[model samples]
Target: MKKVKHTVKLLGALVSSVVILSACGNAEGIYDDKGQVFRKVITQDMSSLDTAKVTDNVSFDKFNQVYEGLYTAGKSDKVEPGVATGEPEVTNGGKTWTIHLRKNAKWSNGDPVTAHDFEFAWKRVLDPNTAAEYAYIMYDLKNAEAVNMGKKDVNTLGVKALDDYTLRFELTKPIPYYKEMLAFGTFLPQNEKIVKKYGERYGTSEDKSVYNGPFKVKDWAVEDKIILVKNNEYWDKQAVKLDKVNYKVLKDSQAGASLYDTESVDDTTITSEQVEKYKDDVALKKRIMPATFYLKLNQGQVPELKNQHMRLALAQAINKEDYVNSVLNNGSAVTDGFTAKGTADAPNGKDFTSQIKSPLKYDVKKAKENYEKAKKELGKDKFTMTLNTDDTPSSKISAEFIKSQIETTLPGITIKIKQFPFKQRIAREQSENYEISLSGWAPDYPDPMTFLKIMTTGNTSNNTGWGNKKYDELLKKANGELLQNAEARNQTLIEAEELLLNEAPVAPIYQKGEAHLTNPQVKGLHYHNMGGDTSLKYTYIDKSIDRKTGKKKTK
Candidate 1:
């Protein structure tokens, strides 16, 4: 990682608006009522802005606006063109993808964005020294896994830039969701010169990198605020409605709602308390997010957690039904599996949740029996474990509730709650530094594999240090031999999840249901349950709202 001096400074005037691929891609036409400012509240501090290193939703949202990938996730999760010209030319039974880059796409620094940028960025994610946690997401690419494992050269990865505009990549197998995968922040392009120049410091600040998307970073103050202004050099600048995007960090959901009530922010994700307060409010939109929050036992970090009896005891001690109903007043519901409820459909046209049956439940008697067995095995009469979670109000409440439940149900067990800022909590989890951590996953794609693959033996995301050979074998078949057979693949995933849950590697808590108080005037705010939270590029404030001073806005 050494500094490079060659910055692609393509000195010229701005280009015309780039061509959008399809109608469902977005709402076409300039907005007459679009406001100059759009304000929003975030629950956590950003982790990273570099596409190769970004793993959090907040950073992913920023990455989506500042750096264009080969494709963009459009309205209703539709695959939309970003730097890509149009639909890619597929060949070799979908194993190969040949895409043409839009020549008009330019970075904020006036560099003509080229295929080479994508080639460098993808390879960088796999570079051993870079230590990218999401590199496993690209394991579908030929030689990508081997490169990340340090067994093969990164250049051997089956991706190439035929020229300035043409980019091609070969997959080890036909990925049905390849187009959707390309829309992820991990695949976003980067300027090699800027990256090499910044070295390890890339994405830490605003000036370290350049932007090629709808907006550019005007300023970024760590844990304080991030201000993004319109990227006039962007190819689709004309279509970008907001002149400025303001993201303020407010971990307290109640404070966020207060901001919304005061009209200081256009949107805020409310907590369960606020959900109850705004039960009849029209502005409070309840959505069952395509995400799951669960309890993960760190087998490597704690020896007792490796015991099936202890794990089962931990899993069965807490009542998910009560937790979701009382603790999470949001639209969340008890979940038995890690895969979300609405993510993918099974062969019988049911969601993955309805198909998997696990033995996990909140039975006080069975939980006590398992604890006795664990104590017998460990030769200990008493045990204590720490529960790690984010410092957000919602997470703190969840942890406290879980702690109280587990301690009351199991006589000799004590639970300690360790709260860290969101990003620090993620860092500690990835490093396997906690006993039992409250973890959540929002799917990167619509497929069941997006939820299932994270539990693979050596995956960077498998922070639990829980692994099963049989589980891995089923996933292997699902990804390989069953790629063509949808029914078989679906069944395989169900079986895999059942096996994993029954073993108590992790306890399925609840599927998140987000309740957000949004200004009625916010229009075309492209949002999905997965990936980034929202695309500010498409969001516009259409009109003013005179919110009631002290109560939830009913209008």
Candidate 2:
């Protein structure tokens, strides 16, 4: 199954430790040689540049810079044409779409960016042996599911290259956001020649990948630094102003922010602990990311989590409002459902959050009552569970908060906290090595299925081993037969969420909000609440702006 933009697991857990590096030929927030060079610190290192293999937001961010798909996320989250001329022409009752690609588009290696590139990329990912974790994201394509499950041949897959510049896709159902889905990283076209040559080394380093997007990898010093230079051979090179994009993989937020203070970098996301220091600073920027930071209770590891009352008690024991306003202090939105607000909308075109009642709201009395019932059911008055989290400052704080809340509300319940590095935590989650884990997910697309599909029985992304047949059936129906009726589909999704929350396989704590410091000269560094998080394609530096005065300079 597809992993969350896992934003915008650790979207709230931003930055890990830093190896302070000198400026990359930049002066006063501007590159000395090429003023368009943009420098910033990233939360994590890019896992892979191979579009088929990536399962994290950090990789997705770099993918956005180096690849172009049928569609791309423009500034302000607007959908714009990348290789394709525009949206596809709907036919065969909206199941089949024919897209016209830009004939002039070429990869960094000078190969024509053709329809076959996309077809090859899609088929490669759906191939069962490829073992792509995000193969489910492309399940909307006809036969994509069967192909990924090893039940069908890759050639039978719905996507086809009609010619050199035109591509066609046959969907299992008519998807209204199908155009937007193509803009996703999984859908980005890959160079067939480069993949064949590089083999296992493909996209592992700067030399192994070719780009058709605005930038190409200039240098990649894994876990140290990554530098992307503008793709001169790109179809629309004029639109890309930045000559270089520099990213330093840092573990701590304060070190990054300090670099920003020294005018060595452009922007850095501040940690929760540092929020107090920059609460009133002029350069401080805050945004409530559309993401859910939640607890994934591993029923397989801890048999008690399988109990509905135990899950309910855990859900009700915490005060979400206090956690958001006090602990986070970054304008995070509180919700009881897995699907974050502004993620999807109802058939009536209203916010989905507005139409439903939150089933997991906090109530100490309910928590206590449920706790007693859980104790009786288990015939135990005392229990202990370990909570897993990353080593980031934010993750540490959140773990302590949850441990306190559960232990305080339910007496005799001992909670142990264990921390691992960011990637190590994901490894433990996949292996089911802990009782409870604090993780997060951001939408890959603007649909309920993006969030809902993870929890279905046996989805790899479903770190929690909790599954209910009814909940799975509801999602299947909503995304299947109910696609024709938006209202009915919305209702079905809502029911599924309510049912799942009653079991609390993964109880949501709060929507993630980001607090950071950005250079005044930086413009169009858009942070998306949905898929891709942020794209640097439209991000440019305005040299006319004075660094200190926050005003444009004039002759």
Model 1: weakest 10-residue lDDT segment is: 7-16
Model 2: how far is 346 from its true place, Å?
1.2
RMSD of each: 10.8, 4.9
Best by lDDT: 2
Error of 1 at 494 (Å): 1.4
TM-score of each: 0.91, 0.92
- Give the distance in Å from residue 507's predicted Cα in candidate 1 to where it truly belongs: 1.0
Cα lDDT of model 2 by residue, 1-555, tens digit: 012213313443332212233454334332233568888887678778899987777788788889999998877667889999977899999899999999899999899999999999999999998889889999989999999999999999999999999999899988888887888899999989999999888998989989999999988987778888899999999878888898877666667776776677788887655678877777788887778889888989888888888888898889898888766777687888788888887878887867666657888999899989999999888888999897765566777778889899988788899988777787788778888988888888888888889999988789788888999999999888998888788889989888888878887889888887888888877777656677887789898887655688877
Compute the lDDT of residue 25 as modeled in candidate 2: 33
lDDT of 1 by residue, 204-323 (tens): 889999999899998888886788889999998889888888887766676666656545677778766568788777678877887888898999988988889888888888899888
In model 2, the runs with Cα more than 4 Å from the true position are 1-34
> Any runs in candidate 1 off by more than 4 Å, and if so which?
1-35, 544-555
* Per-candidate count of clashing residue pairs (backbone under 3 Å): 0, 7
Candidate 2 residue 500 Cα shift, in angstroms, is 1.1
